[model samples]
Target: MIVARPVWAGSLSFGLVSLPVGLYTATDSHTIHFHQLQRGTSDRIRNRRVNERTGDEVELDDIVKGYDTGDEYVLVEPKELDEIAPGRSRSLEIAGFVDLSEVDLIFLDKIYYLGPRGAEYGKVYSLLEQALEKSGKAGIATFVMRQHEYLVAVKAENGLPTCHTLHWADEIRDPKKEIGDLPGKAKASDKELKMAEQLIEALSMEWNPEEFHDTFQERVVALIEAKRAGKTVEKAEPAAKATGAVDLMEALRASVERARSPKVTGGKAAGPGVIAEKKPGAKKRIRSTPPTDGNGG
Candidate 1:
């Protein structure tokens, strides 16, 4: 069994009880990455922090965060941030416990596994986990990690405690303000609504994450193999056309039939761009890259 190294170590305090614990990341990415290279050469492209005026590479130690205010930039030292929330950096103090159901799903962000620092603190950890599990509640806390303060909810999952970082309330954008063409107060016909419900029910299945794999990544690997062997890769089929309002009912009915089909449920049919099987030792050559968001952060 492989034991993961902790990213952060601190004491979790709730009321009078405090337990030494460590936080480990609960998720990983398996995206294939390629280095930026010159068009005609194998030379790699790299990023650097350099002075705009001098075009000289700057040492990381000499870099300080600056906030632009139109008139001037306000520089702040890294140590100043830690000094402002010194206790938060090493303490996970629960403010209160709240019903897990009451928390909105949109607020939840990254998840991390929390474990006891040593055998001596296992009992305390277990007690908190069991209590939270039995009560169906989560302990809300705030702590600083890597210079950023995060709101988190510690809850029990599969006999262990898991910490989920939460987005601040203000961070959630109002859909009403952001979406210009939202169909507000629009009502569907009873027949159409009933058909959609049936389609949903037909498509519903148990949440087994193991059943799904990254088909797109597999195609990427297949493309690389095909190119290496001097073979041409087939293009994927075009996506189904969007249904107009006039054809909505017909589309829903067709979707329901498709959902109930045996091929979609049990049979393995190689559709466009589907790779049947990966070659042995092929995965070893693939490099894992960090997952990026819309802004490429």
Candidate 2:
């Protein structure tokens, strides 16, 4: 495998021991991308950063970060933000260790592969990876990168130490507030519950990332290939029929039967039970961690 350039060069320090390391991105996107074009024309659509009031294109150097105060924009210079940014200590200072399970999935963000900075550091690198693996714990550390500091968990994955940036407590939003009209207690019939349990048991299987894939992305690529060949592209398949709430038991029965069927079952694989049915003309959402959103996909 080709090694990638490290995104950040740093050292992981715990107690008095320090291990020089490099943080490299661990994932890549496979989504099909397209350029915008003017309808009915070959002209490509282009976006420009222009002043709304002046209707003039704004240059990158003239742009300043701004915060809205409801009344007006509070213009802030990039240097001002950098001045308050985390120091360039280049050290991932481990504050403590915690059971990996204790850290909620919601808090886990982007992942990066941690590699030894040099040949001499291999022993120490392996030492920490082995320790964390044996103890079943993740070392909690804070590291600064890209003008900001991140709270991260370092743990062993596939014999390699990986660093996972975690969201601060305040950054996590409460689901209760985000989701409204909570459903009250509604008891299901014993038969219904048993059928559901049986359905789950029939569908349960070990995770095999290979078994699942981005079907939508594959479809997009196929479409692009057909267009490039000057051939007509087929229409997308219709979405699964929407069942009403009253059909819950009926749907459950059908699902259970499907899971138990030899033709469909072929032994459970992994990931989602059913692939997502995308609506025609609807936006395609890719599983990617863009820097803006923070929590890495």
Model 1 per-residue lDDT tens digits across residues 1-297: 998889999999999999999999999999999887544344567999999999999999999999999999999999998899888899999999999998999999999999999999878989999999999999999999999989999999989999999999999999999999999887899999999999999988899989999877887777666545534455554578888999999999998998888763332222223223323434233222222221210
**Residue range 227-296, candidate 2, lDDT tens digits:** 3443333344345998876998999999999998885423211121112233344344222111222111
What is the Cα-based TM-score of model 1? 0.86
Instruction: Please list the residue runs of candidate 2 whose C-alpha ends up more than 4 Å from where it truly belongs after superposition.
Output: 1-3, 67-76, 85-89, 265-297
Task: Please provide the root mean square deviation of candidate 1 (C-alpha atoms, Å).
Answer: 7.5
Residue 19, candidate 1: alpha-carbon lDDT? 95
TM-scores, all models, native as reference: 0.86, 0.80
lDDT of each: 0.83, 0.78
In candidate 1, what residue range of length 10 has the lowest lDDT sum?
A: 288-297
